[model samples]
Target: MTRVLNFLRRPFVLDLRALALLRIATAAVVLTDLAIRSTDLEAHYANMGILPLHVLYERNWNAYQVSLHNISGLWQIQALLFLVAAGFATMLLLGYKTRLATVVSWLLLVSLQNRNPIIGQGGDDLLRMLLFWGIFLPWGRMYSTDAGRTEPKPAAYSYFSAATVAYVVQLALVYWCTALLKNAPEWTTEGTAIYYALSLDQVLMPGGRILYQFPEVMRFLTFATYYTELLLPFVLFIPVGVPFWRMLFVVVMYGFHLGISLTLFVGLFFLINMASVLGLLPTPVMDWIDRQVRTRTQRLQPHLTRLSNWRSPVRVNVESSLNLPPKTIQILHGLRNAVVTLLLAYVCWWNLDSIANPSLTMSEPLRWFGYLFRTDQHWGMFAPAVFKDDGWYILDATTPKGRHIDLNRKGRPLTLAKPASVVSLFKNDRWRKYSENYLFVSNAYLRPYYCNYLLRVWNEDSDNAPVRRLDVIYMKEVSLPNYKVATPSREVLCSCETAPPAK
Candidate 1:
């Protein structure tokens, strides 16, 4: 017990400057995101803020009425909570009262994220989780409000080891899982899946229709894509030949993401994936970048110096020329004022976001990055309508020949929805087994590329066809999972439209 107590209280040396900088940069980016999103507040409110935090709250409270926009809590009460959250976040950024502020900030952020339930569960959210884990590390030693602690550097090093590993491991897991999920039959079956996907107007690329003319290339790409996703996990881990393979993977991934951004219109997902490249980059890269900035600054310094000298005689030395406070007195006074201002500002910001809405803030980037936190991705097969049984809903996909071929309801087809009618489908036992897994789910999902390109589908209901709208749902991401993987937890909600009456 004494040993445990001592361990918890041990003094550690940490590079507070680096940690503080990371915190500040992350906060600034988040603040920018918040400002950009502020205008969409009404849209979010209409959908209950679309943040996952809100969903968690609604579930916990069993009260759907206490949502954003309609915010029913007393003004004073909400303000207090918001203040505490924001104040704690500021303290964390300034490296003051770190232990307490860290915990308080994490709780408040999580609370806020929960309030929205839909908006806060993305790559940024993952980073925030990682930041929380980093709080226990000795990151407050150098650039913090408590900068002058007399702790040994090695003491802080131990804390960093685990925290760093946790962040890296979690990030790797996300990629691995994503890759594994892309190996669906529709994605690998070659010319068939891409055919149907390109036909969908929303997902059309620049020359997608023209590219469809070459069926062979589509088939080749389908096979290449599956192997690429399947091999990436091993390439990332192995020691000798891994680096070369990983480089190839990077090229392919960047091309794929770029293509999606240009052609598919769903660029946000790709943008987030590309930003994740930062995880693989070491701090030395940032250091190198900083050095280059300094070099550039030095090159320009002489010119700036001459300009300053030229203006010196004419410019007023304001404070000194105006005969203001003496140097020593001013220095002391400035420091004192800074501390007071920081405290007050922290309080004000915390209350505005944390308490008032309890749906605005989230954990810092580092902590959330420690885990691959994502919502359910279980888009079932897309067709015109939906059909549901006890736990399963068999879906249909069409072929180019225009025949009604069903995998679950009728029989497996070789391709997805290309023909006006579903026919000539392909289904192996493995594919059939995996489709069964989606039986109980109710949200976005992905299946493997059996023939080529990721063939995505969703199973949902719509108000357009009240009675007959039980059809299969389909959409495509450029990739699919074709590797061994741990199946994800099933808790998805369907937003897919099922089969409906013919117009």
Candidate 2:
């Protein structure tokens, strides 16, 4: 029975030092994401921006979702929250009060995403879920402020728990669910998914443009991508040659995501995915990394000592435990384990719903629980087929003197011609995501708000290019086979006229 239990736990054993690395990497990502989002505080998070608080409550907000950003619509308030979130992320990076920092960071991330659902993508979900599981992980057990100067024992190098299982299974589910949702022939037999994906000039990077010229290469890569997403995750749990299999999985995924990052404008999606698997690297690799780090630290010992002497000695000890009876402590631990197991099961069920089969459907009643924790996720990115409707926005506007201007080009003359690089038009990937959502028929209500926001932004210095009306135009370019390019059609997505200059 002991042997059997050990076998069962083998694949789930996580290297604690790797977990510590993951904690630091994830926290850095949180800080980077926050900094990027901060640039558009008024535009994305504030009420006077693209989505007002009332409009969000009416159209986009759900009952189970919560956001601290909802407390005030002002950019200053949003900035304050961003700063607070950044502070927590910093604490998490240093592993000072790690569990607490992780929990708060997860909360703020979910709140920020919920506040602007239109701008979210699969990466946001992955980041949120990683932090959620980190709350239960002993990632701060080594190489952290919480760990202090105490070195870990050999046994402490590895950890096995319900949270570790959840983390592993969660990553597998992301790839598997995304593959399952991509039932379209383009991802399977046709093998044109990559071709179409790269064809999207809106997201085309230099690598994609170069690769787009090679159709045969695209088809081969398309098959590789699909099969990798489908089959590679299972390698992570193989019992035989455990370390070899784990290393193979990690290496393959690193290349896979790196390939994606090179060919697409996915922003931090690849980085987050890559970070999610850092803790899954085999113990030997982590051991090597530890040795290298120790060597480097020794080299800098003198400098570090000087710096340490100048700074006041401050150790943020996070070691606190209840002095409960043995039986009570056991009960509490079991309860915590049970809750994690249950949550992991629920997350699987939630992901199953993405397959879109009625017989395999997860009950709606259980979803409120997932949403309450903000663990509800969808992995259908470029799935069921890549988006064929590729386009660039034209913020076509009319001046008070009836002159035509394009706010998207910063008050330049309005022209329907497509830009040289549509990807460059977006300020960041978040805005690119919002623009993608805006094209969806279901998101038609989002158009007027965006139009109004652009108009307001343009007219503040009305003397230069005062506008009476603004029209949000979309130039739709559908991907065609045989390397054919479809002619783009100009469609007026939204037209908003400002209330006649205070009458």
Candidate 3:
């Protein structure tokens, strides 16, 4: 038992620099995500948006699932929530009130994600989990405004703790679960997963188009992706040569995500995954980075000194002046540890249960806990099989003047050439996610909502005003070897007419 405890505690001895980097990266990702969502606030968040409050509640209502977003149907309210989320993210970035900032950011992220579950992806899940774990970590031990001012500086590394164990295990489970679920022949025998993924016009980027020309390269990448995911996670457990393996894993995985980012526009998925890998960066790497930064700072010392002299000297201390009694501090620490341990244990159970039975249903208590904390996780990402069908959406509309036009093509006729990047049709990731969901015919509930939303958008626009009717059309392409093309099929999903104002 003692040996087991020690083994589990090993990860807690983390390099503080790595945690600091994680704080910065996570904050940056949060801010970027907020900025992207802000571009189409009404469409993604407001009641008049594609996923109105009524539809969202109807689809996802549960006794335990909660969100501040449900409190208001107004765009202004959602905008306030967005601003509040941004404030928390900014606090996290600056490492001001680091733990409080992490908690607030995580809560806001959960609320926003629950607000429109349809638009969420694996990246959002990973981001939420990271923030959850960040709450228990002393991430502000170094390079943070929350760091001690009176006491001596903290050590470069943190002591081993259960939180660190949870962090490492959670990351490993992501890869392990994803690898186990990918039982498709393409991932094993055919090595065609990458080919099909790149062929998908919806997610494909410019680099993917170029890479599609090389079948052998795609096949190689498919095998590499699967094997790396399947095998690399085991390295985290090896006792000897851990640093070497961990560093190698970080580098390879970071590069893999970079390649994915270039080939596929998966929103913040690549960025969040890359940031998670930063935790595995060995102490030597973190030390080397610090050395490089110090060297650069020394080189620019004169300029920095001049700039510093120009600004008024300000000393802002974060430590509390009223020190609590020893007993009170001990009690608080004990309570915190207990809470963290329980949360980590519950999360572990959920992960193991998911792996044991992908379709397993949680008990009411577990489900409630997951919903309340927004810690629910699903790791099936392109598992079982890669999507064989890929398509683009076209909103066909008829103006009052009797002109038929594709709303996505700036009121041009449907026969006009498709855009080079179909993704450009979406204002943000939320719209892209909704578009992907609408591709499935069985998602009947989304059809009317989306069609009506599109009609409203077109009619509201001065350029395409006085619209008569609108039809949601999907143009689909199936993958073929040697990049062969088949006749595209145009299918109408749903139609809506502009409702005249009440007299």
Best by lDDT: 2
lDDT (CA) per prediction: 0.40, 0.85, 0.79
TM-score winner: 2
Clashes of each: 121, 0, 3
Q: Rank the candidates by TM-score, best first.
A: 2, 3, 1
lDDT of 3 by residue, 50-135 (tens): 88888877775677877998889888999999999999999898777888899999999998998988888998989999999998
When 1 and 2 are scored with TM-score, the better candidate is: 2
For 1-503, candidate 1 gives per-residue lDDT tens digits of 98765453222211233444455444344343334333444223222222223333444332322223234323343445555666666776665666676666655555444444333324445444434544544444434554433333332222233343343334444544444444455554432454454444434456665665666776665556455544664544443443354445456667866765664433234554554333333234445654665566675766544222210121222355566778865775566446534433332333233222456443444223212222112212221111211122324344334543443433444333343311112132122223333342432232212111111221222321122112343322222223122322232233332234489
Q: Candidate 2, residues 208-269: lDDT per residue as tens digits?
A: 98898899999999888888889988987876787898888889989989988989999999
For model 1, the stretches where C-alpha displacement exceeds 4 angstroms are 1-29, 46-109, 118-125, 136-160, 188-200, 203-228, 235-259, 266-268, 283-287, 297-503
* Candidate 3 off by > 4 Å: 1-12, 148-150, 295-335, 356-361, 416-419, 500-503
Using TM-score as the yardstick, the better of models 2 and 3 is 2
Candidate 3 least-lDDT 10 residues: 306-315
